[model samples]
Target: MDSSLYALVEDLRGVDAAQVLSHGVSSITVGAAYHRARDVTPHGRTRVTFRQDGIHFPPGDLFDGLRLLPPVQRDADQEPLKALRDQTRELGVPLHGWAVFLHSTTLGLAFPDVTQENCFGDRAAPADLCPSNPDVRAYAVALGRAVARQGMDSVVSESLHFGMFGHGYHHERSFVDLGSAAEFALGLCFCPHCQARLPGAETARTAASRLAASVLDGGPPATELPTVLEDYARSRTPIVTSLAADVADAVAAEGSSLTFLDLTGAVKGYADGRPTGGPAADSAWQIGVDPSAVSDVVPSYAILCYAHDEDRVAEDVAAYRTALGPDTTLRAVLRPGVPDTTSSDHLAAKVTAARKAGANTVDYYSYGLVPLPVLSRIPH
Candidate 1:
């Protein structure tokens, strides 16, 4: 079985790289474009031992014209990526660069015009970047090449698609009922670039407003609006696919492959520990993700199987395998602790189910986030 573990730069300071390989983990996916890391030293919890820092790696020369945000300020001696890559290579374990592309509070706060604009002409989400914008796409391509140049054999892409209202800002309060239609409506992006491609954008915007108002007034949303809104959402599919192709080209040029993770399953119900079906399975389209269309362009498709039940995890894996088909690599990511996982045996069962469901590779959600004992939960 091909197994890989995800890690943050903070993990390297406390956990030994040799220990990770000793656990039968053949590959390590380190955060390259991560937003933040809360470090916990080996010593017991103390005020001095805890610290939070954003931007794991430093900015390089390739990001000159990208109009991107500068990485979190660091001391002159900090060099996390180079150190981790060198140690992992010496241990004979491949290092895959983990990156978050579109979701950025830093960039959105710095440049609000490029952030997603909701139906009510609200630009409150500073975490999401509009993929339709030329500048956003250019920056993503540059980031892809930069990660590859850092000696990563492959790159894992996250948050590259459309984002929901709850993604960016913190301390949110969605007091209204916000039925399914209203939720989708509230998440739609109607920025200038989005409107340019959507011919019926005004009509869709009106429908979203009405649906949201009805929910806010303690009433059910009209049924007809979801279909209309979905049509508008689907219009952005080609643009998303184009951006994926551009990033793929960039990664290939630098001698690395791209593994695009489809977070739709988690969005549907996997994260809630429930089975996903019907319209929820297709919700990836709302965020401009048509996995089937982009399967040929990217080398691998990763499915987020954060569900509780092993059987449902297998079912989700099977669905992704069918969507991407046999030609593309299907990787499944599982959470080994917290709400979904109970014990190592339970984690092992989920891993077995993923393999039986046609997963080409199985990777865990994170390393530093989980306790040292939980690392034993991974199947060898």
Candidate 2:
């Protein structure tokens, strides 16, 4: 869509969309809901009008717009890209591609070697992969490249981390290779390499073997964690680091430009005698940081929500700006339609707050969760 048309749309201008797309839009006004995390539905449904066509897409037709389908295996997944690219281009909106990195949903079938085990000696995870497996790393890199080749505007690695959930570290009975408690706190990989390496190489098998020997299995050996963590980071970072950098490289090769965003939770919040924490909007950045896990490779975090409290939106953004440094950008998600909240209009207010808090760019959920009318609350 052309900026003139987008302006027409923003101004409620009565103009032809067809004419505008053939041209280009000068600016954009994004319409979004508080959340796009819709629950399981038989088909994808976007609850509002797409700026591209202004057609209200039913759930069935929304999947492609959301990029939920798989890319063409042989075409480097670029087969169904024209429609997606055209629609986005017509709308003058940038895309944020979502990819579930280390965690794959293809268990019991594709790449089962990395699946985690349980006390029953059976695969415990549904389809999640172990982060430390080298093959798994390669798979992630390949998948990223595939997506990048498809011309995604920006890539967000959704779940690039250890297993989703499990119980006590059962070295002899579970699928995960456990490392020291510190490693666990800081994103432990625990594959054979990680475990064999205790601060670093203390895999479940090694830990059990050593523990069984009754040598007190004391402290993690010196030079163990730093060395192991560095290696772990190197191996793990490529999965994402490569994907992000690859997208940039791929776009550059084609003489195009794209942005790569990384998200994760670096700090923990204490409460209820338990350590609970929120995850990143991108999910993959939660881990031990090295230049690889996060580097110039990732430009910024696309969207961030504190989950516990949206009122803290400004504060969280402020903290990230300070800790990560101002040049590192952030996108703050706002939910103004909370059932009984009266503090402020959600999207616009949050956008304003983010700017005041030093955020230069922004992205938010669309239509269903947040309507276009919400823009009134945000002062342009």
Candidate 3:
């Protein structure tokens, strides 16, 4: 199995790179573009870092067919990605660029029209850029091509589809009893761009609005999604597939492959350990993701195995293996510490489970977020 570790630019300092490399990791997935992060090191000092509106590295003169809404920024002095890329190359380890595609609070807040609009007309989700929006689509395409141009062996795409209401804004305090289904209904984008694609979008919007309103008024828990809304949600599959195709093409042009990271399993695992089976596995549809459909577009898929139980993580990996078929490259991402992790032994067991479950590769979720001692958890 291919062994890799996810890392931030700052993690390339001093002997940190050498230390991680000593763990027998074959590749390093560096975060080229990302969202806000709050991490604590072994020293007990916690730091929260936020990016304004751009990439860690300097951009090329032209984006070819891709475009950015607020323009891409860079920190030349740090040259984070480039420096890390060189460091990994010297160690004979391949470097893959990890890019956060659509979740941009800065650009979304700046361009609310392109942001996702809930059924209740709440465009408060500043971190979620609507996939149906033409500009956002172009931006994602551009991001993939740009990251590839940085000489990465592969590009791991994150948040490439629809984001929910639970993902955005700050200091959210909800006392209302908005159940999962109602909250999901309210998170549906009713923007003009989305409406133009679905035939009965307006009707679905009305139904969703009523359901959300009922829940906000302290109604019973929403057990299921309205049929109209469900159909509307499924319609997002094609949009996401097309976007993936564009990104695949962009990555190909740069001689780098695209690895689509499906967040559906992670979503389900985090929100009550419900298995993503039956109509629920299709909940990925709600997020504009259809993993099986995208397999034809991208050559590889990285499924999130964030569940607490090692057995549960194995099951999640097996499901993706079955869905993506035998030929598609399947990689599993594991969080060694924090959240659910207890010890390095726990991480080792999970890694063994992933490999036995038919994963072609296993990758650690992050390098900077976890402390140095925890970083040693990667099984050599």
Evaluated at residue 127, the lDDT of candidate 3 is 85
Q: Write the per-residue lDDT of candidate 2 for residues 1-380, one digit (tens) a residue.
A: 11111121222223233332332222332211011122221111433322221111112222233312222222222323334446567766653344545443433134455654321234545345564555555544444444444454544454444443332122225323344433332233444534433343434334433332232245432223344334444444444454455545544554333333333432232121111333232224334233223435555554343233434555556655654555554554433333212343454566566667766665432223333343233333
Clashing pairs in 1: none
lDDT of candidate 3? 0.78
Candidate 3 local lDDT, residue 181: 81
Candidate 3 local lDDT, 216-242, one digit each (tens):
877886868888888888888899999
Task: Report the error of model 3 at residue 291, Å.
Answer: 0.9
Which 10 consecutive residues of model 2 have the lowest summed lDDT? 1-10
Order of all candidates by TM-score, from best down to worst?
3, 1, 2
Number of backbone-clashing residue pairs for each candidate, in the order shown: 0, 26, 0
Candidate 1 Cα RMSD (Å): 2.7
Worst 10 residues of 3 by lDDT: 42-51
Clashes of 2: 26
Question: Estimated TM-score per prediction?
Answer: 0.91, 0.54, 0.92
Pairs that clash in candidate 3: none
